[model samples]
Target: MSEAVQIASIKDDGAIPVYVARPAAAPKGAIIVIPEIFGVNPGIRQKCDKWAANGYLAVAPDIFWRFAAGVELDPDIEAQLNQAFGYFQQYDPADGVYDIESTIRWIRQDAGAIKVGCAGYCLGGRLAYMAAARTDVDASVGYYGVMIDTMLDEAHRIANPLMLHIACEDQFVSAQAQAAVHAGLDGHPRVTLYDYPGMPHGFAAEMGDRRHAAEAELADARTEAFLAEHLA
Candidate 1:
């Protein structure tokens, strides 16, 4: 079983709310799980629990708390999407990276983890890459990150191990963008990219009917293996 705890973030200008999930036993490592623009919804919480089940202390910070507190998007497709995209534009990626780094530091100090990694979905996924570029994370896993192409120029500077899971049929991310990211990391031995054919943007989200069971399972296994190898 996993336990949920509330953590406070440093007040730069305001307070940030963070939710942490961990197993009863000592953690092997710590993971800073970043959430999508919808904030730390049930799906994100499940992701944290999944990580905790794998022996890592997982913490997810409310990235949108600065804009709105405890946001939960409606299940209606159009409404949910509008809310998700709306928050995405309101918060800058730099802020997300800083908040994530803060969460990482908090976990390192409170949980006493030796190594740390990051995993995120959608907007969080893109932020995962940015966190890896800016912070000292042991590993990073990005699932269908949209803005990764824009940061290709800085890819060579990334020293941490990075893994990207891309949805080949995703309308939001174009082939050109994927190519740019690949080209940027072409010779980088620390980066690995995988494309899931026919999978949508939030395929790994189990709460929705869009969940691709096989694909999600495969990605989960891959993510676990990557974290175990790097953080263990």
Candidate 2:
């Protein structure tokens, strides 16, 4: 139900390798899956598969292709963490937004998509928020997005539905940062924010040590239902 596809990146004119997943029947909608700093690893691919199984056309782009085209880093490896951060620091979010927008356009034209949303984990979580604010995406969901508080002012620009899952106990996101994110967008009519009481960063991702099945299931359920309602 999944295959690799190549898409053009406007920034470099290089092929951005994307993993595409198709549903057995006509899709209800489409979603662009954005991975953590770890690139399009197994967990991200599985997420795409899950979306496809849920009857949505799903694709996950290798946004880190700019530096490491197909990099998959182990979270437990110190060297890998350093390398991931190196790529993360070198990569620009604006360029990422463009790539995601490109993916959205591809979904729209090639898949005949009626409604399209985006979901991101970790670093991608922030990208999802930026995409919703800047692109034509119909909806977006972000899980434990890092550095989101710095860009909350852009929340006013979102025209479609957005759901954010904040891990309350996440070390990557401080208490003050979570409070800032909530204060900025919680009351917005188009935005919905949920707090996971004791979840950590990457809890929804099926990666080593960090995966929390119960919390992930609950959050994914909410994500699917939200996308269903907004993209229906």
Candidate 3:
């Protein structure tokens, strides 16, 4: 089951709207599911629901609340797509990381969670990478995270486990960016990088035309195992 809730944010003491999903029984751990620039829509909520069903407490924060609160836009919709990008252009990753840090604290200190992991998609994927580098989150995963190669300088600060899914042919992410990400992250003991040869951005989306079922399943299985190992 899922509910809409608000959590305390360190930035300006604002309330970060969140979509929370709790397991039927006691949760084994907690996961913060970050959303794309499109906001905490159906696809993002479904992710939390799946995690909750699998016995993890899941929360997705509205990191875009400062700009647009409770906004759900479809990437496939032309007008919404442009609106989403406009919000994306204004988003600051540093702020997103702080919001993630607050979520981590709430999970551990307030929610009594033993361990916390985070999985992010698209814009969220980028935030997940930042959380891995900048927060106390125990584990982090990113699917088609954008601009990760630019922030690799912070990779040295990653103290816990991190798994990243890269869509090799992602239209939003250039081949050079992919190459840079590989060069920066490959062989990093704490980070695991997986490349999807023919996939594009949002290939693992819970819904919509972008989802590639087979590849999503493979990546999700890998993600689940990674979370289990580290969060355990």
Question: Top TM-score: which candidate number?
Answer: 3
After TM-score superposition, the amount by which residue 102's alpha carbon in candidate 2 deviates from its true location, in angstroms, is 0.3
* Tens digit per residue, CA lDDT, model 3, 1-232: 8889888897766889999999999888999999998999999999999999999999999988987998999989999999999999998888999899988887887568579999999989999999999988999999999999889999999999999999999999999999999999997999999999999999999999999999999999999999989999
Give residue 111's lDDT in candidate 2 (0 to 100): 87
lDDT of 1 by residue, 43-82 (tens): 8888888888878788888888777878867433788879
Ranked candidates, highest TM-score first: 3, 2, 1
lDDT of 2 by residue, 178-218 (tens): 99999999899999999999888888877678889999999
Q: Which 10-residue span in candidate 1 carries the lowest summed lDDT? A: 2-11
**How high is the CA lDDT of each candidate model?**
0.82, 0.91, 0.93
Residue 45's lDDT in candidate 1: 86
Off by over 4 Å in 3: none
Off by over 4 Å in 2: none
Q: Return the TM-score for each candidate structure.
A: 0.94, 0.96, 0.98
Q: Is candidate 1 or candidate 2 better by TM-score?
A: 2
Clashes per candidate (backbone, < 3 Å) = 0, 0, 0
